[model samples]
Target: MQLSSLRAIGISKSFGAVAVLDRVDLAVHPGETYALLGPSGCGKSTLLRVMAGFETADEGRVELAGRVVRRPSPERGMVAQAGTLFPWLSLRDNLAFGPRESGRGDTEEIVAGLLEATGLTEFADALPRQLSGGMRQRAAIAQVLANAPPVLLLDEPFGALDAQTRLRMHEWLRSVLAARETTTLLVTHDVDEALLLADRLGLLSARPARLVEEIPVPFGGARGRHTLSDPAFVRMKAQILDRVMVA
Candidate 1:
């Protein structure tokens, strides 16, 4: 499978006279996940918003699968930190909304499977208010998957959860993405989260952000940051942490 280019070339974004990002370039190949890690005000979320088309880049371009994704199209979907679901809608209804809106031939069965996969089937009829934080977030992600987006832009998707829940969600996300191998770009401030979930990690400098470093996570039996017990993993984490804190 030739995973297409999900590239951000010399991307820059500004709000009026204040700039958030400058000349930041990101390239995530098909089936690979890249975590964008930086401290607060470093433009991680801003970059994600631009990639999701919620904010337009002031300069540079975004290209997907050889074509420029001009605006917020369903080909791309976002999972926000808040899991911004419709409070009044039931989980099943929320999943139905996207496919139904797109006229994509009734995704009922697909939605059912996704709900089950995300462990939300029992809560399908529950409103967002009735679900736990993790469940609601899972539903939000499932809702996006219903549309079958080729690329997923996750902006601190699990940042709001408790530490235990956040780690569990990372484990769950790995299982979910395994089947599809969907290209993903996740923006996160937590170093451990990035190390655990990403195939590669990119570090950025503070506001008027620029790419500073890229690290490829090793694939092995090491689970959690406990994997840092390995000498190589320990060195990698220390190196990335040093760059992050110093930046």
Candidate 2:
């Protein structure tokens, strides 16, 4: 299978002479969830911004399904760390916001379907303040999904939730992504989350981010995530830790 990959070739970025990414190469195959795992202050989020077309890379190019992603696009949807929702707008309206902003004609149907898909149907009329942490993120995700992007960029999407809620949301998101056959690139530091959700894991170094290591996660399907707790999984985690720490 070709995997309908998303790719970054010889990517590099710098901030006022501080090089963050040093000619990094990355690829996330279709239907495969990839995790960019690294320490805080590492360039994971910045790299994601570059991938999202929010920040232009000084040197590099991004391609999705062989087409260049030249600008910030609804085609590369994003769910950020913070809840990026309108306080005054109801959940339903928020979901419809993206499509409406894009001038898509069928906003109602699109929003309705996404709200239901993300299990927000009952909370459709609720404001951002009325929703729980998980719900807020879910709404943010729904808002992005309403645009029906081929590639989804998630930056610590479930990090705001409580531990229990985060675990539950992880399970739900894994199922949702698999069901939709969505191609995703998720930025997360949680080893368990990376092992559970990612098809492959990319480990990055601090300050100047480089591909310290790349490991195939072997989590082929949502149901396969549990295998991450096995002995083989522990060894893999150890290997990734070694790479991150040494780099």
Candidate 3:
């Protein structure tokens, strides 16, 4: 049976007098990738933070695997733009940090596989400062995946990379997430990224963001770079662009 891996019910948040999110409701099914697309300053990251338990909402609640999320849990791994990796640790050790701290016994094997999967095997002994922006983000992803989280919260993880690198990261991330069947909630301003990666794409209004529309991508499962040229993809991107522009 299908299950909801993450849910936000009537979530509302404000910073001082500036309201950010308002009665936002979101549901990400198990093993599904959901992307929240909106304009700049639309509070997409704020909502993601709330879901990750990095920030609290003034109203409503968020749940992961049916458990109320009151604090950050390793069960839900989060990856932000860049610079999330520990600068002092090598790529391999960074991947092992989470599990080792949690007392998991398979740290060596896990780190080894993660390094290979993320294409960081050669740089296993390299520190975060020794890597490029994209490589650091990949390492961060590997570090989180090492914990084997059921849900992933990504906030513009590739936003800092160049166009070419961003596209590669997108393809890499899609494959890794699919292989693990991990439920993911991505906050992105990139339309093509959302169309290419999301099982369901949601649009949020300007500020005090609320989910204004939810679109289920009809593209068959297992997408790749070629999917970007599909007519359906082009159409959906246009439609979403129109909506976001108007909002």
Residue 145 deviation, candidate 1, in Å? 0.7
Best by the lDDT measure: 3
Q: Point out the worst 10-residue segment of candidate 2 by lDDT.
A: 219-228
Lowest lDDT 10-residue stretch of candidate 3: 1-10
Candidate 1 collision pairs? none
Model 1 root-mean-square deviation: 1.8
Predictions ranked by TM-score, top down? 3, 1, 2
List of clashing residue pairs for candidate 3: none
Stretches of candidate 1 exceeding 4 Å from the true structure: 220-231
Candidate 3 residue-wise lDDT at 164: 89
* TM-score between candidate 1 and the true structure: 0.94
User: Over 4 Å off in model 2, which ranges?
Assistant: 1-4, 224-229
Better of 1 and 3 by TM-score: 3
Predicted candidate 3 versus true structure: per-residue lDDT over 68-129, tens digit per residue: 98788888899998647998888888999999989988899999999889888999999899
TM-score of each: 0.94, 0.92, 0.96
What is each predicted model's overall lDDT from 0 to 1? 0.85, 0.84, 0.89
